[model samples]
Target chain A: MEPPRALLFDVFGTCVDWRSSIIREGEALGRRLGLGTVDWAAVADAWRALYQPQMETVRSGARPWVTLDVLHREALDRVLADAGLQGVPESDRADFTLAWHRLDPWPDTVAGLHRLGQRFVVAPNSNGHIALMVNLSKRAGLRWDAILGAELARAYKPQPEVYLRGVEALGLVPSQVMMVAAHNVDLVAAAACGLRTAFVPRPTEHGAGQTTDLRPARPVDVVATDLGDLAGQLGA
Target chain B: MEPPRALLFDVFGTCVDWRSSIIREGEALGRRLGLGTVDWAAVADAWRALYQPQMETVRSGARPWVTLDVLHREALDRVLADAGLQGVPESDRADFTLAWHRLDPWPDTVAGLHRLGQRFVVAPNSNGHIALMVNLSKRAGLRWDAILGAELARAYKPQPEVYLRGVEALGLVPSQVMMVAAHNVDLVAAAACGLRTAFVPRPTEHGAGQTTDLRPARPVDVVATDLGDLAGQLGA
Candidate 1:
């Protein structure tokens, strides 16, 4: 098969260690507010757990298209209320919502991206909106050619429009673009849309006990242990 | 005034030397196709001359939204017909349309963007769509955080939606985002939308004998000689 002309990435668990980053942010906020012995890890999990259900609201047309920031804020409020922290200062809550914008990349993300970017156009085609992606890239040193995905399509992942529009935005046919994602479901969805796919597992994306997405649920064009391995396999 | 949080750039003549780049592409195409003694500079000017009128059709709702690529191709066909080069092969014509994608950046563009991006979110807020901007940025070594502007708004420059949506995409208020352009009218429109404005004159943008946009027609927050000066003045 001909090599893909561009690589579209899945940001959260794929490029960034979002779970760890969110926990770190939560713990730091807890310390700043002198809220003793908060289980930020559990809070992080709770916040992330709402991601899909929230997106489903829009994907299913139950709600209008809103930015990931808006969804994130809404999710954060629910998470806080569930944790009995509804009394937290609005300023701190706002900062915590932005913590998603400050995720740290997996160890190989930056270097691998730089290497792959030398060969193919590389960008995040994730659920995050432009501002969130920009802030995340700046903090993580992820060099993207463009931010393409949910915001551009006004639809969430698993929706064909998100992947199709992203491929079109790069001036390439779906067949000429490769979707690089850790989630088997994301790659599966992209493959269905006629794009190539790469699976790079992040075994501990949801912490060491994470069992889901430890392996690709189906075959992909390339499978590797990490971004660096994927880059090497792609000859980038 | 508080400093701007993001810097939105006007591409084409503002960041890349479009006139020279088009001339170069045209001349090279002419040579490869055995067409001799063509005045490529005139062709470049003619092609650019159609830019405003084409975008105006969309801006005025006389036509629906289309990518700049489509507008450029239509303009190119007209220019070719007028130049008595309508006999050019379809393949060559298609390639010529993509010449806009390979524009060379002004001498200071790369370094200036590098310096400025160290401090602020720097992105192209141009009439070009995402694919066009991505290709141009790659070819020009312009490191943009997020490709914003016309594509995002589905409207061209000088339109309020173009500037306002670009600012909103970055999660910044109009006052916290600065629109930098070589064109007086572009800056004026952006300023009217409540965005801060910086004018960096491109005296030779339309060629040595050109007279338009040599100076700001109205007051702007900052005026500089070029991108480098803009960066320095912005303390980036």
Candidate 2:
């Protein structure tokens, strides 16, 4: 098989451990708000659990497509209420909502990306809006050549359109690009569209209760321990 | 005055010394093709002289919007003929056409942008297409936050819609953006649409034959020696 000319990454749980970051940030916000002891980790897990169903609502045409920022905001409001954090001021809520933009990268992500970037065009194909992704990259030092977001497509991933649109924007054929992800579903979707796929397992992405994706579900171009290993495997 | 949250720069004369690079490259190519003792610098100047009128063709609706890549090709063809160069293969012409993608950045540009990027979002708002700009940035070490180009707007710069489209894509208000250029016309056009402006003197941009933009023609928010000075003036 021809080596991929570009690598499009799935950002959230794949590049960064969003669940733990969100829980930590939530715990701090909870303490500051005098909300008393709460299961911040559980809240983070629950909020992530809602992510798919919420997107499915839009994907299934039950609701209009909204940017991940808006989807995340809506999820935050609902989860806050469910967690019994009532009467939160709008300003405080806004702060909490932006926590997604500040998630720290996984240990191997930065150096690994820089190494891979030396060989290929590397970028995030995330549900995050362009502004959100740009800010996240700056804050986290993701070292992306460009940020490709759902906002540009007005559609979220695992949708074929997102992958196709991103490759087109890069002036690359889908076959010349690889989709790198921790999630099998995202890789599968991209593969179906003729993009090469690389899977790096992130078993704890969903936190302590995480059960699946301890390893890649299928044979992919390069399955490795982490992004650094992936970079090595790709000869980058 | 409110500080612009983003700065969009003009690329050719503003960021890179395209004329000298092209002239040097052309001279080398001329020698390889046995076209000895040719005045390649004159050819470079003649090619650059076609820039504005070529873009003007698009701006004035005499031609549909074409990327700087296409315009470069047209200009190269005209200049090659004018210089009476013989037996230039199609492949050689294609390679020559890509010279725009390989132009070297000004000495201060990379470091200056690295400094300014620590504060304000910076990007190129160029007549080049996104692919051309992206490749050029990678090749030239230009540190743009995003690549905004005429292809995205389907119009050339100095067009209000082109300026406004960049603002909207950035999720910024017009006032929150600045146009930085070596040309007074570009800054004035951007200012007319309520964006802030900065002028950087590139008196040698057109070589010793330079006759315009010795300094800013109008009151711009900041004037500086080069990008490094601009970064210093912006307190980055």
**Model number with the top DockQ:** 1
TM-score of each: 0.98, 0.91
lDDT of 1 by residue, A121-203 (tens): 99999999989999899978999999999999999999999999999999999999999999998999999999999999899
Any runs in candidate 1 off by more than 4 Å, and if so which? none
Residue-level lDDT tens digits of model 2 in A1-236? 67888899999988998988998898888788888889998788888888999888877888888777788889988988898877778988888888888898999999999999888988889888777777677788877777675766678888889999888777789999999999999988998888999998888898676788777777778787889998999999
In candidate 2, list every pair of residues with a backbone clash.
Answer: none
TM-score for predicted model 2 compared with the true structure:
0.91
How far is B77's C-alpha from truth in model 1 (Å)? 1.5
- In candidate 2, what fraction of native interface contacts survive? 0.23
Evaluate every candidate with DockQ and list the scores: 0.85, 0.45
List the candidate 2 regions with Cα displacement exceeding 4 Å. Answer: A56-65, B1-3, B56-66, B81-86
**Candidate 1 lDDT, tens digit per residue, B142-198?**
999999989899998899999999988888899999999999999999999999999
